[model samples]
Target: MKEYKLSGWPELPASYQRTAYQRMLHQMSQGFVPLGQLLRVSGLGRDAVRRFLAYLQASGVLVEREHAQTPRTLLVMDWIRRTLGGTGPRRQA
Candidate 1:
């Protein structure tokens, strides 16, 4: 089972104007996501997700993550924090 992560904002080709790809990229921008989830959330089939991922990789916009070692709870917490704009800790003088 291979996995990919969003290295950063993708420089999409102007010709590749697809909403499904856009949605997948948006979700990936949030954090690392499995290919399965990408397919489910993007509402795209397995082949579509796989092809899109390959395209992103070939474009050098996708980087590999160290597998899905991240705990589900942590992922949820991170999502919540992002949703509420709270990313833990604060620096002050």
Candidate 2:
């Protein structure tokens, strides 16, 4: 099988391209890194990350839960994760 490499980055929707979304995905994959650390890992501006997270919430891809005084984003990656059943139906617009 030919090994396929991505050309640049995936052209995600504007909602997904937000820094916050990027940071959230990165943290979910890499595990609980601090904001500063996430910034270093994501290579995006602080403000941009904030906006990305907002988009993720709006898209219903993530949910926020309050703990004490702070809110933490809960990953809903399972919506995309394959299950024991057959492949899920595509989302409708």
In candidate 2, stretches whose alpha carbon ends up further than 4 angstroms from where it belongs are 1-11, 14-24, 29-33, 65-93
Which 10 residues in a row give candidate 2 its minimum summed lDDT? 1-10
On a 0 to 100 scale, what is the lDDT of residue 25 in model 2?
75
Tens-digit lDDT string for candidate 2 (1-93): 111111222336855656655555756443333556545667878797566555544555443432222333222333444343446654669
The most accurate candidate by TM-score is: 1
How much lDDT does each candidate structure score? 0.76, 0.48
Query: Residue 4 CA error for candidate 1 (Å)?
Result: 2.4
- TM-score of model 2 vs. true structure: 0.39
Give the backbone clash total of model 2.
Answer: 2
TM-score of 1: 0.62
RMSD of each: 10.2, 17.7
Steric collisions counted per model:
0, 2
Tens digits of per-residue lDDT for model 1 on 31-51?
A: 777777788777888987887
Evaluate residue 63 in candidate 2 and report its C-alpha lDDT on the 0 to 100 scale.
39
Question: In lDDT terms, how accurate is model 1?
Answer: 0.76
